[model samples]
Target: MAAAVFLVVVVVGIVSAVVAMSHRSPVVNVLSLVVTLFCVAASYALLGAEFLAAAQILIYAGAILVLFLFVVMLLNAPEEQRPKEPRPFQRAVGLLLALLAGVGGVAVLIGIEVVAPAARVSGDARAIGRLLVGPYIFAFEFISVVLLAALVGALVLVKRKH
Candidate 1:
């Protein structure tokens, strides 16, 4: 069923995102991130948001991820080195924090109520464009400026003298 596939894709995305963070090598992390993004695109497709799915793949997975890999290779980032042995106190603190997070997540899940939205085929390109340029125009422009600023900042940082 579509629901089952969507669930699987979302699960894969979440798991890959976590695994990406845990990776020591930057290349592996980026690769896992790509997988996570692809899973997100897959879920968007399952939801019938074909435009969103294409944007996810083209923008995040294609452009942004390629840019990340280019920067990584250009900078020649080294693999992270871990201590051969873990510290007892650090392990205890990590476990405590993880347990606390797990408990908080469970509590939040139990407390939240699900409110389903009315069904609409608002995923069409024309509908999405109209929504973006209509009432949401200011928000859309603001986000574009923010992303542009971020891109400029990233370029500046990457080109900075050591």
Candidate 2:
């Protein structure tokens, strides 16, 4: 079932993201993050959001992950340094958050009911393109320009001397 597959992919994505954070090696972390991203795309596709799936893969998995890897390599980062034990307060906060998240997840899972959506031209590229180019053209263009500016700003910040 699509619902089951979506649930599995979501679980996998969350696990991979956690694993990515735990990994000491930058390359392994990046790969784990890519796996998480791919899982996200898979879940999107399962939900019939093809455009979102493609955007997830192409933007996060392709561009952003590659950029992270490049930055890692350029910096020649060593294995991540970590304290053997977290501070007591930090550990308590982490535990509290984890417990709250687990409880919330269980509540959501219990509350979920599968229902089919009404038939529609979901993820139709033509329809999306028409909307983007028609009523929302200016907003779309503005967002693109803002994203481009942010990218340039990040590059400038990274290259700047302290």
Candidate 2: TM-score? Answer: 0.77
lDDT of 2 by residue, 97-126 (tens): 999999999999999997897785588577
Poorest 10 consecutive residues of model 1 by lDDT?
117-126
> Number of the top candidate by TM-score?
1
In angstroms, give how far residue 95 of model 1 lies from its true place. Answer: 2.3
Clash count (model 1, backbone only): 0
Q: Cα RMSD to native, each candidate?
A: 2.9, 3.2
Question: Where does candidate 1 clash, by residue pair?
Answer: none
- Estimate the TM-score for candidate 1: 0.79
Tens digits of per-residue lDDT for model 1 on 1-162? 887887889889999999899989898899999999999889788777989999999999899999899989998999888857879998999999999999999999999998896685658789899899999999998998999999999889879587
